[model samples]
Target: MNCLQSVGHSRFSALPWPKRVDAHHRRTAVFNGFVGTGSLRVAAMKTSSNSRSSLYEDETEEQASSLDAKMTDLSDREEKSEIYSSNMTQAMGAVLTYRHELGMNYNFIRPDLIVGSCLQTPADVDKLRSVGVKTIFCLQQNPDLEYFRVDINAIQQYSKELNGIHHYRAEIRDFDAFDLRMRLPAVVSKLSKIVDINGGVTYIHCTAGLGRAPAVALTYMYWVLGYQLDDAHKLLQSKRPCFPKLDAIRSATADILVGQWKARVTFKWDGDDCSSVDISGLDIGWGQSIPLKFDEEQGAWLLERELPEGRYEYKYIVDGEWVYNSNELVTSPNMDGHVNNYIEVFNEDVNIEARQRRKKFMDGDAELTTDERKMIRQFLDSYKDDADLDEEEAEVRASATSDAIASGTIGVPDKA
Candidate 1:
């Protein structure tokens, strides 16, 4: 079967004699082709079936009652032993056998990466190491480990001392999508580093290997391996059964446009008694217009809204006629193959006042001398012309230019 159906069938009965009734039935089943492995100890009931039958037929009512009480007492003791048992060997045996029967704990997503459930016991580390796993990356929080009875310290110690295997842990709360997204970067970065350094298989796991662990793996494929988000999900699901949260992975990678910092942009059209003045461009989709209200105080038509950090090309429609501000600081070719007024919205953190001040200067929202505006316009023009440069080289040049501008330098020439 189905992996979940198998797990539901065996979760309680996986261990030998966890229940008294199951224990009693095992004696008859053992003779009927029921094979037990060396790892698991299949215990049988102390009283034989023949004796049980005889006791029911020949024994007094009081004796039968006494036997029933004795069996109940035996069951209570067995249950206690099962709960209080800390024997690593027995736990490993049960975990291994359970994993074998269920057939869905772990699988190789990539040749170098195996993703699945947590290591249930210390010996699991050794078993994994035998399969050429040089690193074990766990994504369980402390409560999950305790609830699953996973002796993390023992596993770590055994991995280091017995096999020199590297074990790393990220405290990603199980089933919490927000926490998974927040912690994905550090976890993926660390996993990538370990895989590069170790050069062997890395086992990544959360509690059930379904949600958090799979999300991380999928994001790694998308962010690091350069797989498209959908393609990465398809490849991962093909390798192993999982329910990865795509939203969580997308959020971590900044693929969605929501939640980013937006700079307040004000579009101004200086005109008198226009029937309708509208601003239209790529930022708000072509042909769609946001109407600009006449500002009685500033004596102009103005539209203001927050726009995400990016370059946008927009033009004014003054009474149904397309118009461009020839004096605008920035201009770029539009989708309709016409030159249009543009502005650069820079990325900013949570400092609202600082962002507003920068926006005023860069977007021409503040008063500036004619010469100062011309200088600013020239830098933007040059920057747009060099847009096709490699990203790393552009970043270095941009940073150097920013510093030079702050130090009152006009421009710096390239070395060669």
Candidate 2:
């Protein structure tokens, strides 16, 4: 199977994080690919602490000077910070100016992060390494690499040979919005490990560096770096000329609040007489369906899958007829304006009070009470603690207490 289809399978999408690769196998693969290049020893795998020892090593005076200038400029900049994006529109003029400045496909969007097009040649790897990039993150699928004649095996070999730079790949399809949204969390998680845990200057790229690469970079800044979504977009736009699917990024960030929790969800249908039944949605992807097996014991058709905590809209196809749940309370209009059954799956860790407020908002109760608004705000703020572990333990504990208050496990004086 091609990389795109392979990644779409449960092996990748079913997890909250990327599947771990064995270090030995990876080392062996690198060794085998670079056997004739010269006397080259395979270094630590991406997950190895030994590899990160050299992340900031061999710094040239030019690189140091460049980094210092960047930091100084960043400190001097006065960008307004907010918890939410008041406006989501792109700055078209800034985008054009940045694109004009980006003569090459690659440019440093941040001090530690470089967003660029696919690395087409081994020289490209050398170019990036010369700038102190310790990690190369490729977001293109196998087919995309082949189309560009990008020798990925050679790129990996070159990255390994150059100060043991880490080469990581996420097989995301070109222009696939759904795949981008679904896989973005895992992408950002790996990027976080490289930049935060490993202390590496990471270069992220896709086929053209226009779509997936920028999207991942923007999401990282927004989700992990605590920039508001619009601020993150503006930051990236000011550096690189590209359009990331912002809506998908926003959706992914929304999912992150509860993405850590996955519960085995079962969809049941009382279609005993129907010849077949199918259940779909919540990572099954709308318009696609997986069959529900007959359950004689329960006297119903059942489909069970581990789903991350979120509200999912789905419909049942019984004997080739699409139908929503008869109970209108659980039914909502789908994108096509058709009524569909919706389910809110959550674990005990979920802040039920905040969830209830969100559900009320979703159910057309836009006039939320003062307490409800506060609960929702606290819920979002509490999850921001996961953005950075280096934050104070006391602050994290307080966020946890906020979560408890939102969950109604802790009582607070009625401020309203």
lDDT of every model, 2 decimals: 0.58, 0.58
Put down candidate 2 lDDT per residue, 27-140, tens digits, no spaces: 111222433111124233455565464552333333444534543333222111010010111111112111211223788888888998777677887788788876788998
The local lDDT score (0 to 100) that residue 34 gets in candidate 2 is: 36
Global lDDT for candidate 2?
A: 0.58
Task: Give the worst 10-residue stretch by lDDT in candidate 2.
Answer: 78-87
300: Cα error in model 1, Å: 44
Model 2, TM vs. native: 0.44
Off by over 4 Å in 2: 1-108, 126-134, 140-150, 163-166, 170-190, 196-201, 207-212, 223-226, 237-281, 284-289, 294-301, 313-343, 347-416
TM-score of each: 0.44, 0.44
In candidate 2 the C-alpha lDDT for residue 279 amounts to 60
RMSD of each: 22.2, 19.5
lDDT of 1 by residue, 1-416 (tens): 00000011211333244443632332322322434433123334466597776564343444434544545554543443233222211211112111322322788888877888778778788778888887788888887666545678998877656533677776775444445655776667656655554556888888667667888888766655556667777788898767775655554444121234667877788867787898766354342568989988888888888865545566677887767777675454433345667776655564676455444433433233455334433332333212333453343344445545655665556799
